[model samples]
Target: MKTRKRLRSLGVNMIACLLSLIMLIPIVLILLNSFKTSQAASDMSLALPVGGLHFENYTLVIQKGKLGVTFFNSLLYSSGSVLLCVILSALAAYVLSRNRSRLHRFIYVFIVLGITMPINFVSLMKVMQLTLLQNTRIGIILLYTAIQLPFDVFLIYSFVGKIPRDIDEAAVIDGCTPLRLFYSVVLPLLKPVLVTVMVLTFLNTWNEFVLPLYFLGSSSMWPMTLAVYNFFGMYVTDWNLVSADIVLTVLPVVIVYLLGQKHIVAGMTAGAVKS
Candidate 1:
């Protein structure tokens, strides 16, 4: 039995390593090709650059891809959506978790059900147009917030449920207003989950491609994903430049994830087993 268990464990570890490599190989290829000459990158091989790195690929991509404007657009959309989603989801979750009323319960279920609901882009675009939000920056930000709210609410809802009510009661006894209670007392306690939400929302908004394609008609307002797509189309043969553009587009997301990864793990596992 001991030998069999050891074999099983080894097999599992081997499979896990293989899967990790499978996912990592493409990223490694992209990074390597981004530094190679256009001819060298055309094959998209596993081999490293033969000569010195072609650092000009990144500079050319930044210029030709108009990445400056797109980077700002992505940052705006992601930060705006993250702020809105975190604040709104936290407030909604806290209230619903604390109230436990029939209506609140129904509302919470309805919102959470959105997680599985498929978006009808045609109708969504029509709504955006009717609201005079099409092709607008704030409109796209709000769209991202709406898209992310369901999961954000669900995550924060579960976390809020884990927080003890005694703290809320004591704050009320101390003459804390509802806003003060939440901002000062509850919000501080929600740091782990809030950080998780911010990171997730930022990533989602930053990487979103389809919504901008449909709703944003102006190229100037395009985010990094759309910029990368357009850059790919314009420089289809320049694999090195395309790879560089892709790396630049994903760099911010990678940095953010690396910084907040610990918070993400802690938040996700905080109340998982109910102690």
Candidate 2:
């Protein structure tokens, strides 16, 4: 029995490693080809950089990609969405977790429905136009906030449910204000899940493409993803610069995930077993 279980575990581990490599190969190719010359990178070979590197690809991409401005815009959208989403989600989750009323249950169910529902882009665009928020950063941020709030609330609500009720009672008995109690006591315990939400939210907002293209009409307001289109003309595409742009664009997301990786498993599994 022990030998059988050990063999099964080894097989699973090998398969997982193989899958990881499969996922990572494309990223590795992009990084390698980014350093090659335009002609070399154009071939899109997955081989080593044998033809001496073209370091100018990075500089030219930085200039042509308008990376400075686009980076700021991306940061603004991602950070704004995350801040609003996290705060509102935290507040809503706290309320839902603490109050088991039918109203709270209904709200939670509504959020689940939101999760399952597809975004109505046309209606959202119309609403933005009416509010005079079309083609603006504020509009995009608000859209992101609304879209991300449901998932954030769900993750936090699950984590919050696992917290001991004794902590809430103790805080109340000590005359702690409800707001203060949540911030001081409950919020601290929610760090793992909060980090998870922030990482995932940041990634989604950073790499987002279609929404920004449709909503942000002006070239100056484009995010990194949209801004990369500058490297192409109607006739020719610069693969070298494009690859370099991709590397830079996803670097921050990769770094963030690496940093927060430990918290992800903790956060996801924390709410799995009821306390």
Candidate 3:
């Protein structure tokens, strides 16, 4: 029985590893072929470059695509939006979860509705124009914050509910004001959920193309993803440059995920189970 159980576990592990490799093959192919010339890539897409390392593709893409500027814009937009979402969501969730009232429940339901409702681009466009937010980085950032608020709020609320009420009561007894209690007592305890919100928000905003495309009309304001799309269109035949751009665009998120995978998994699982 012990031998059989061990064999079953090993089999499952093997299957999981195989599936992971299968999912990673495309990414690996793109990274490898990014070094190859267009002809080489077309001839043998799967194989790595034959003639040593080719840094030219990276240089060309960076220079011609203006990837540096676009990358900075993406970083600014994603980071700023995620920061705002985490702060606002954490505070909102704390209030809703801690303060039990009909109004709190209504607000929670409204936030959930934000998550359920599909983004209406037509209506959104009109709102953008009315708000004078069209064709601007700030517009994209604000839109991202609004779109992502629901999920972030939900995650934080669930986690906050798991926290004991004694903490809040004790803080209040100690002459801590509401804002001070939140910033000093509650925020620290909600670190896990905050990390989860930050990771999700960053990924969504970084990969978001539709909003940026519509709101950021100036090529100078394009994010990395949109810039990559433009690069592909202009250099349709240049597979090397295209692949390099893809690698560059995706590398940051990949690195972030790798670094924070544990926190993300733990926070999400804890929130889901607690809720």
Candidate 4:
């Protein structure tokens, strides 16, 4: 029995390591190729760089891609959307979780329906036209907020429900207003889930391509993903620059995930075991 258990453990470890390598291989290739010259990259696609590093590809991509502007645009869209989503979702979730009523159930179902239905691009476009949100940052921000709300509300509601009602009662007894109780007491207890929602929102907004492609036509307004796509179109034969752009686009998300992985896991697991 001991030997069987040991073998199973060893097999699982090996499989996990293999899966990690499989997932990492493309990223590794992109990083290595990003440093090669176009000629060298094409000629020895799989080979590692020789001697000194060739950072000319990075310089060229920076110049050609207008990466700084694209990165800034991404920052604005992602941060703004996330802020709106978190605040609105938290409020809505708190109301639904703490105030039990038939109306709360109806609202919950309505929000959940948003998650189930596919986005109607045609209808959304018409709505955008009426609202004059097309080709505007505010429009994109609003759209992202609406699209992301359902999941955010659900996640936050789950966490909020797990918090003790005694806390709210005590705060009210102490002459705390609803807003004060929520802002000062409830919000702090929701930190874990809020972190998870923020991280998820950031990633989704950052990687979003189609929405921005349709709405943001201005080159100056392009985000990292759009910038990378434009770079590829212009430099179709320049593999080195393409790879470098890919690396630049992917690196930030990777860094964020690594930094927030612990928080993300804790947030997701917060309500799993009732305290």
* lDDT values, one for every candidate: 0.92, 0.84, 0.88, 0.88
Question: What is the C-alpha RMSD, rounded to one decimal, of candidate 4?
Answer: 2.4
Q: Give candidate 2's whole-model lDDT.
A: 0.84
Candidate order (lDDT): 1, 3, 4, 2
lDDT of 4 by residue, 108-201 (tens): 8799678778987878888898999988989999988999999889889888888999999999999999999999999999998898999988
lDDT of 3 by residue, 23-140 (tens): 9998888888899977887653688688887889899889999998999999999999998999889889989988899999999989978878998898889999999999988888
Name the TM-score of candidate 3: 0.92
Q: Report RMSD (Å) for each prediction in the order shown.
A: 2.4, 3.3, 2.1, 2.4
**Superposition error at 224 for model 4 (Å):** 0.7
Best by TM-score: 3
Give the poorly placed runs of model 2, Cα more than 4 Å off.
1-21, 229-236, 265-275
What is the TM-score (0 to 1) of candidate 4? 0.92
Residue pairs in clash, model 1: none
Stretches > 4 Å off in candidate 4 = 1-13, 266-275
- Between candidates 2 and 3, the one scoring higher on lDDT is 3
1 versus 2: better lDDT goes to: 1
In model 4, what lDDT does residue 25 have? 87
| Error in Å for residue 178 of model 2 | 1.5
In the range 1-275, model 1's lDDT, one tens digit per residue, is: 99999999999999999999999999999999999999999999999898898899999898899999999999999999999999999999999999988999999999999989999999998999999999999999998899889889988998898899999999999999999999999999998889999988888788889999999999999999999999899889999999999999999989988998887666556456665
